[model samples]
Target chain A: MTQVSTTISKEKCFEQLLLGKTVKRVPGQYLSGSEGWLEAVRAEALENARALNFPSDRHDDWRFTDLSPLFQHGFQPVSSFAKLTPGDIEKFLIPGSTRLVFVDGCYDAGLSELGFSGSAGAHGVTVSSLVERIGDVQVETYFARQASFKQDAFAALNTRFFEDGAFVHVTGEAAAPIHILHVATRREAPSAIYPRCLVVMEPDSRATVVEDYAGLEDGVNFSDAVTEVVLKDDAQLQHVRVQRDEKNAFHIGHCSVAVGRGSVYAATSLAFGARVSRHDLHAVQMGEGAEIRLNGLALITGRQIADTHTRIDHAFPRGKSVQLHKCIADGAAHAIFNGKVIVHPGAAGTDSSQSSRNLLLSGKARIDTQPQLEIFNDDVKCKHGATVGQIDADSLFFLRSRGFSEERARNLLSHAFAAEIIIKIPVPSLVESLSRTILDRMSGVRT
Target chain B: MINKDSRVLLEVRNLRAEVVVDGVRGVEILKGVDLTVRAGEVHAIMGVNGSGKSTFSKVLAGHPEYTVTGGTATFEGRDLLALAAEERARAGLFLAFQYPVEIPGVSNSALLRLAYNTLQNERGLEELDPLEFEDLVLEKIKVVEMDASFLDRSVNEGFSGGEKKRNEILQMAVLEPRLAILDETDSGLDIDALRIVANGVNSLLTADNAVVMVTHYQRLLNYIVPDYVHVMDGGRIVRTGGKELALELEARGYDWVRAAA
Candidate 1:
């Protein structure tokens, strides 16, 4: 066997490619965060990014998803936007409560509304950005606490190079949902955008935060995003992440969450676009009785590739976690799903399950799924499953035998398969839109 | 074909059809089958297994697997073979399966309404809203003696054999197709379920519609009597007789029928 070292020269490294761009920080936006926290993390992340190579297929975490195509191009900084319009942002805007709109990796003040408060203003919440908040000890802990970028390159790049990030903190009281839109405008040069988000749900508070990602279909673009979520004791947070970028774009995202004692955190991601996209999600059950649910749906077509990797760490006793991720690959599209759940010692009575199901519409389309369970203590119930197959011929014929056309039968069945995860999303209004997006993005079969 | 003088609802003339072999060349299943059904009549076709009893029924309904090599099938003077499966259904022809496929996450009520609404639109009739459709479905469930909860559950998913057969009968009741074909719907049903399914078919029968049943047993005919019985051998109807032919064949067996043909 040949021993190969995972190393890269300075010219090919992501840090060298993305480091020289000047980033402007808009002050006074983050009401409760610290800028020094970001600066402190950036220094370490830059050092790590410079010394490490971008993750290749040689890496176990990225074995199925290839990043060579992303490495070929030298992405410039996002210094200019060819087109940024209100209609572009408004067309995809889901009408609801409070929202923050970011266009081309910068906060769009005109399109944003920061009215996250109770009716009488007594239970008013702070929805700000990291560029505005002053440095403090608690802010530093939430910012740099959970997501360890020791072996992660994109995450380290996110820490060092984000233009700005979203901040939504619940002040121990409940309020309406906070919807954030991260829209990408077509840039003059082939470039990359790092948009980060932070959600800190205070103890005993309950809220929903929806992060929607979209882009114009002009040309190729690259997006690397990192989202950090902190849940205190007995807090409940429903996080919905949507990806609807250009077909020529490449997107990589990392979501890190920490669940406290008796806390509940549920997240659902609807990934529909991107030339090649991979989302890595991780959640740690830090305290006892913590519950976490992770659900995802990916529909890739043509030569597009979509992948999702998730890991749940059940550290304390009485923790329960469930993960269900599904993808439909058509044309020559490829999808990868890898899920792992670790039940450590003292995590007794832990119930954890992970399931990944894939559907191939055409003969050439393919999927690779892996579900791993690492358990150390007894007295726990844990299960993991992965399935990859075409649609059931019997089911198709059964529907076609009825009044349904062959195309309609495939659509209905495919929709039903993905609906298993979509319906689990707590947000009611998202159901119809997500359904339409999945049908729209599905390949091989025309609806 | 039998009964040329009657007002024919469906007429099949020298129907020769085959299914694709390995998605390419033809493997013939129906070899020149000729049958005719008149309005206000229920015709039962009985044959042994591998005799292509199910294929003939499927070909008439425009199943994509079966290709017509040589045939002229007319439903109400329209060329039935040229239409799609959904178009044939919209034109008031229904085929109840021997084994209904379970479609998970799609409720029985939703499927029924979709089929009903498509047919209604084809007929230029007013479509029923969800509430109105629910009321109609609840009323029709009694025809099959089915529980009201079945309407809300996923179509045929986790249903017993008897329940699936009853669900098909209930669909027949709601759709009210001009020609209803039951392809061995009684194959797996018990005596009580067979009676209920037959009763449901009987209730939907009218002077303007017709029924075609493909079965291997004479027991189904006991509940809802047939107007005529045809014995199929080698994909063609070799003998045509009244309802007694079914009982005679059931008692004597297919060997005698084959010998007689």
Candidate 2:
């Protein structure tokens, strides 16, 4: 293996990169005199990002995933927005949805359909660009509050440089699901884009949102995104995130959610593309009687790599959490999953369970799964399990004896392994589309 | 019942086989066994445990774990040992497993439909689509006394012992094989399940097909009466007789047969 070591440390390299990339603009008015606060937050985040070192193999969380392939390229920021027509993005659109489309980190108002207005104190819902809603107090209070950029380098970079992204605020029942689509157009040089989103759901409101990331062409690009979600008391939200970038792209995503009292939050994330990708998710129950369900699936082939790290924190009494994560790796691809559930002291009657299941299709395919649980109170109920294995021989033979060819049987079993998670996506259209994608991708899994 | 003019379906002569462990052959299990069966007939092979009754059925189905050292077994005048397990199934041979494996993701209806369609396509017959196949499988599922929900669930993933055995019979009904080998299909079944499975097998029998059941007890025979009973001991059949022989063995036990052999 070729070594990518350099005399200049990764921290210094990124510090110089950040120094040259930081930009300050005359910001829009938000809640009267909010411009100074935004700049201050940006500056402090940039400084914090510069002070921290890029994760190396020595880091406990970064031991299995080597970022040398991503760090080797010095990706430049996308200088110009690539022009795209309505037909160009027609395939990613979901029926009965209000859309917010962003091309290369820049919001395209012409391509977006906002069913609700951005006026202050909107009653029902508001789905618009983040930069346009700077006047809302909810945006100011919850924008960078939930997901801390102080320790995470990628989140800090996204906070410092993101120009515009989707902003969804729900005060009542939403009539249609909101779809936030981010597309990366191929460029001649290696480019980088930062995508940001903030969602605030008030008490007694309900809604569903989908965060979709896609690429137009197969080339090297970097997408660092951060999303903060706050579910207030008695609120319900279903979030589905799909990442299907190009084969050579690099993606890093961070999503932090705060669950309030009597609220329910459910998220399903699917990862299917990118040469190297990583996602970090954190959900904390801030009040009593909160519930959260997290489901994830990662399917990769060839030389791709996917890593997921998730933490669910139960801070109060009577919180419930259930999580399931699965990975299917074929060829020489690698997959990693680390799930942690922490029940703090005084959080009695907390019910939590987690399971991680992995499948390797080839002799060289690899998977590393870790399920961790920490219960400080004896009154809590928590359980976790991890399993890694290949196909069952007896099952294979049974199928063959029923006249199914070996290839067809293998494909059927693998597809069934992934359909368990894919079937849980709330949207019927997205579920069908993703099922087709998985079927097409799994056909190449056979040796 | 066997007709004198019925065509021969399976013929075995001086067959010898053994289990393979890590590519090495173990002790011989089926030592020079011989048997013959014709269409429209049901035969029962009775023996004590480890007498190679189950091994004989698996070896006939071309299970990879067991290797045939020397054998001459023909199915419908074709060398059965020369075909792959799947090819044998396509040529109309079915083995109801003793311990049916649970497939977690593949649905029962899906597997049955695929198996049925594959056989149909191989025979140059019309294949059914999903809707048509569902209709056909729903009809076949009733033969085993299984409800429609069994079609939607994973293939015997969480099924009970009896449910798994019935699932095997369900597959047999859908494939409609010409020669069916029931290997201890009644081992784990209750009294009701045994009758249901036996009745299912009885209903599927026709003038062109035959059933070979391997069981230790004669209780299953009360429902699906066998036309012939063969006593196997020490890896070979020592005696062959009519249905009364089964009742005699149940009364006298295997000690008499061993002493006579």
Candidate 3:
């Protein structure tokens, strides 16, 4: 492990970074298994962070957001914690499937329970800590191949640390969905938790997994995590992520999925918490006859800021993908969405579309949406659109004329806007719960 | 003194309006039109496409696109022009749009409740909660003979031409305005849907309320009879006659009336 020395004060990390001074990179402390990809990831992290230089208020992309929360608290590398126990695992289980729990930055075996009970981890289903599986030659080759460090800074940071993350392998003919629950428990101030999950589904396999980010207490905590997904030929995977943290927490995460030939991948991301949270998703259809569907919804209130950036790359012919993301911004909060669909030169038969719509509840609330589509192949069909506006006044008047109060009218309109996306979620129970949460949030009712 | 049975519900004297566009200027669309609709009577206004039939309804509804340069409308002896569009709606005035706007995220039932509650508040009546409101709308849904699923769908979204018109009548049934103005309600319906919509309107009519049906054809009048039919051209009523006037226009066509006038 290599440790770099830093001359800047802990409180001035963001300021020094903004000034273009080369601050010392954090120590590379691999947990006995990430040696192969450690050096490459660390170099990439330092270069990317230097390029970003801690965005200021002048940056148009981030002008509406106040980044003071990131600098108000310092960052510390967290690896081992004593608060999480086996009992906590029972309360966090997703019900009806296998559960994997990671506390702080290390995978806790005692805190995880496999649902099969008497049956051992069966054929084509391999779940273990990343440290235990890094010796495999396949893991070494595919670690940083699907994920690029230049596109996202947080992914680079998670890769540089290269600690113990979850590694699940689904071999040929696997049917069941692998559920990975990444739980972050905060204990001290200015603490950082870097938890990562790497999933590889082999040919002719199917699986479902959930990446949950939550905080048990209210503290000044930071969670920087990344998940990399690779699907082999004819494999299918369903991924659902729920982000609900403390009001004072800062969370930055990324999910990168690469699909193979004749494969299918569907993912849903529901973001509802964190003072300053951002999630970036990058999906690449690398083979023919590959399909992907992405559905995302965010309910924001208070002074929180949630941003989601997605890029779907069609690298081959006969690839199709659809992305729909909706946001409801209330209070003084701001929501940002940037979705881009690109068709490479040889991807002739690609069909892709993306739409982003936002409902602003107050005049002071803000929403920024940008949908971009670039096509190098003329034979392909692609469309992209974005809309950001307040609730329709005529519609409100029309509703009010029927006898609804001001509050009831607002509630119904906001709920319907969010429900358009929520109803498309595959999980019925989660959809119901999310709808209730959205209604409650809009009505200012406590959960 | 106004007779008890002949009490006037709506009165418009020398009503003049101009169309405003681009915030720069305006053009007169209504030139001193006079109209009086009494209770227990249905008034039919027949006019050409650009004869300001729709504009008259919008002006009465206080649409921001049109400015009333000089006019006075007394509804139940209250100044109608002083109120906003929504205020007028709450004060027992309803205008069924020629083309109902589709609100993508608002459900039909929810919109109806909002209108109902706003009218209640204006009239000093109690408001109904969600459960009670749903029940109220369910009864009206059956009266319009609309499907139960239509209540859950978005307002006018993906509705067929007939369904949209029927939804407008459903709204009329639920709101129960004292003076209902149907603006070109029969333009986009087939024979069957047209009969259904006209029947829905006829069922809602009472001795204490008045209706003003604006149409370009006499097809709708075959079902919903009008007590008095007015011929309007170039922004003003040219002639007034009995219900048989619609039949006479249907048999003789509009050119004969233009020739006779």
Whose DockQ is greatest here?
2
Alpha-carbon lDDT, every model = 0.81, 0.86, 0.76
Residue A132 CA displacement from its true place in model 2, Å: 2.0
lDDT of 1 by residue, B37-137 (tens): 89889899999998888999888877767789998999999999889888888888898987788877677998888778767878899989899999999
Write the candidate numbers in order of decreasing DockQ.
2, 1, 3
- Please identify which of the two predictions, 2 or 3, would achieve the higher lDDT against the true structure: 2
DockQ of each: 0.43, 0.52, 0.21
What are the per-residue Cα lDDT tens digits for candidate 2 across A1-447?
Answer: 221233344554475458435223324412133478788888888887777657769888879897778876766676666778998888888888888988877788777777554454464788888888776688888889977799888888888888787889999988778899999888766677888999899999998999999997777788999999999999999999999998988999999999999899999998899999999999999899999999999999999899999999999999999999999999999999999899999789999999999989899999999888988999988889999988766677787788876777777778878888887888899987887888787663221
User: Per-residue lDDT tens digits of candidate 1, residues A1-447?
Assistant: 221223444355464455546444344333232355566677888787766658767788888997766665667667643345667676666666577777767777777777644122235456765555435344566885666566677887877777777877775564666778888766555668888888887788888888988986556667888899999899999899998888878899999999999999999988888889999899999899999999888988899889899899999999999888898888999898888899999899999988888889988888998898999999899988888888887677766656677787788788778877777777677776776676674433222
Would you estimate the TM-scores of all the predictions?
0.85, 0.92, 0.79
For model 1, what is the error of residue A437's alpha carbon versus the real structure, in angstroms, after optimal superposition? 2.7
> What value of lDDT does candidate 3 attain over all alpha carbons?
0.76
Q: Compose the digit string of candidate 3's lDDT tens values, residues B202-223.
A: 9998888889999999889998
